[model samples]
Target: MTNFDQLHRFIFNQANVRGEIARLDDSLQHIVHSYEYPVQIQQLLSEMAAATCLLAAILKFKGEIGLQIQGQGALKYAVVNATDDHTLRGVARWDEDLPSLPESFAELMEKGVLVITITPEDGERYQGMVALDKPTLAECIEGYFAQSEQLATKVILRTDLSEPERAKAAGVLLQVMPTKASNTDVAQDTGFEHLCKLTETLSSEELFSLPVEDILYRLYHQEEVEMFEPATIQFACTCSRTRSAEALRNVDKAELLQIVEEEGAVKMNCQYCHTEYRFDSIDVEAIHAGRFEDTATKTQ
Candidate 1:
């Protein structure tokens, strides 16, 4: 049996800080399957998928978050979107193949920037951009949390590819509570530094494969951590024929008709779910009517 993908939250009994660790299985699989991506892109997708899921876990609102990595270099664009439900889908855009593997995050995204956008279902959206000069994706994310949210946070991500096509991506986040004061002199109250030190000692394999309790135990055996119920993470897309039809509504009617005349029909495909929605001449007329008749109705 496969271990269920889950996100776990824990807090130090004595410290005023909180932490989260998440393992993504279904979500990772869905992302990699969305396209026939190169091995390097797959690796990047795994890391970004984990990072996005972890970011969603720390939010106190209900919305979707998009984590994007972009540059003018060969790597151009790599992005992942995760929702409050831990459902995720991601894709990458790269043109030519590189001569060699990327040695570090900097090499992959030359002069890149990390763009984070939070879109709440009911409130105004927020966006933050951070320089991607860090050596690793984790470091860039930590930098974002520090500068954008002012939270002393650390993120560690790991992805493994082996036989049987086994792929695992996991991330851990430690953040000082917003209300906590940052001070160095108070040894007893210095939980933030202590937590960071403990988390830094974690290894990639342990983070990705081992159970959450075992990993936390190894990291904080010296201190007490109160663990909470885990939230499962999965690969799910919100795309639907209804939503696709709405997109069709936005396009200029004449433009859509021109394509339909040449191609015989209008086919809309969602990159996130790899699902195609086809609109024939009749369907286009209905779209212009501001209503879509159900496929069932057409068949009838």
Candidate 2:
């Protein structure tokens, strides 16, 4: 059986094109089950999470990448983050009391924008945003690549949210990077488009169930392709009491202490994983005193 939660990278040597196939299982489960998300939102989050993983794995970066959508529609906000190692986490908030939510990306996020943020380990952080002009996230991503880097790219995101308990998400990314070699642009562009057609023939079931190598061969049996080692993708929330405490550093100490006195503890909940961090009077004191990290890590 194919191992779940792995991303396979492949290159078409003759075409000078690269592609990725990712299958997500455990990662989807971890995110969807973290909160009580509506079916529509859950599906959107699943697709965004998978796309984020695919995006992160392809980039040559050392830090994190985030894919986010913001608007005032039924789904107010949704975001997913992925690190260099393909670790991912995501969250979504919407109008829960609505009788029904829009299914299409454009309607779900009226006046929304698709944002991509890249934070490198050593360099400056970069963010790019585009209006939610397309009906799907895949199209918007393709547009992003075209607008930002002027690269020819194709993206496909699929999810099965019919049964929340068995939620599944998977995707593929194909891009034609600039070739320094002389007289190869025509051949590369032709090959890249041909490969994209074959890639579009891939069904959701085949992507979810087939082995990585088999999937590639099924699509590009006639092409000269090289497959690399697969990277594991997982759901990992980068939240903790210490990090949460750090968030409260700039807030009013008097107000925080007042909450501690009235509500018994200052509370902060991670929207991604729903992990709660509570601070009583002593914890509040330590946090403001700049001595909370040591104690918080120990207790956690």
Candidate 3:
């Protein structure tokens, strides 16, 4: 019984460390239901989605974070996006006949690169790339943090795909806060290590089942923890007919009309939500003429 689709943030008052815990149920189900992915693929995407939410919670800005895996093996690519408001959507592309899911990350995503992109609503976008040479996605993410931000980070992600109707994903992240001149290195290191040891004891079953407060109490009851109000996470797709029409406007007019003539309409499907938007010749004409509102009125 997991209370899913929630993100909790907590700070250790005794140490210069902050943590986030996130669990996804309905959001996970919505993503998996969008595609008929294998169990392994679904689990992987679930973990990524959970991780994205956790990372998004840690950000201090107003924007979205995207996590992507590009591989040369059976898993071609996987992407998860989480907005500052906690909306999530994700998709993965893979070879249909993946003989069997590879047991190790290296084998599953051979020669892959993990790319993290942050798009701020008011600032310049940032991107970081890391080689996926680690045994687990969590370790890869930790490595990225260490390399890009010079911060020691630990991440644990778990996914349960046994129940089709109750697919679950959960993850926890802990990071060392930047040290000040007054802060002692030895003290920070000891605090970080102790927190990591406590977090390492978390089992997937416990993580998938326990409430956020209970989980925190179980792990850090000895420490002074300040729990913040939890945030709701949902499966939200940023797709719209207007966006589809804008995409159509990008095509050459001749090519766009040619497709409409052949197929009777230009059909666009959102990969994230599987919603289809169709535009007949008249709609295409309105889009080109910059009179999309008129087309909408006519259709109505």
Which candidate has the highest lDDT of all?
3
Worst 10 residues of 3 by lDDT: 291-300
* Candidate 3 or 2, higher lDDT: 3
lDDT of 2 at 174: 88
C-alpha lDDT of residue 151 in model 1: 74
| Residue lDDT tens for model 3, 70-148 | 9999899999999999999999998887667876678888899999999999999999999999989999999998888
In order of appearance, the predictions have TM-scores of 0.90, 0.93, 0.93
Q: On residues 113-232, what C-alpha lDDT tens digit does candidate 2 reach at each position? A: 989999999999999998889989999999898787667889999997766598988899988866654333643555777888999999988888888788888989999989889999
* Ranking of all candidate structures by their lDDT, best first: 3, 2, 1
Candidate 2 has an lDDT of 0.84
Candidate 1's TM-score reads 0.90
Clashes of 2: 0
Clashing pairs in 2: none
Instruction: Assess the local accuracy of residue 93 in candidate 3 as a C-alpha lDDT between 0 and 100.
Output: 92
Order of candidate numbers by TM-score, starting with the best: 3, 2, 1
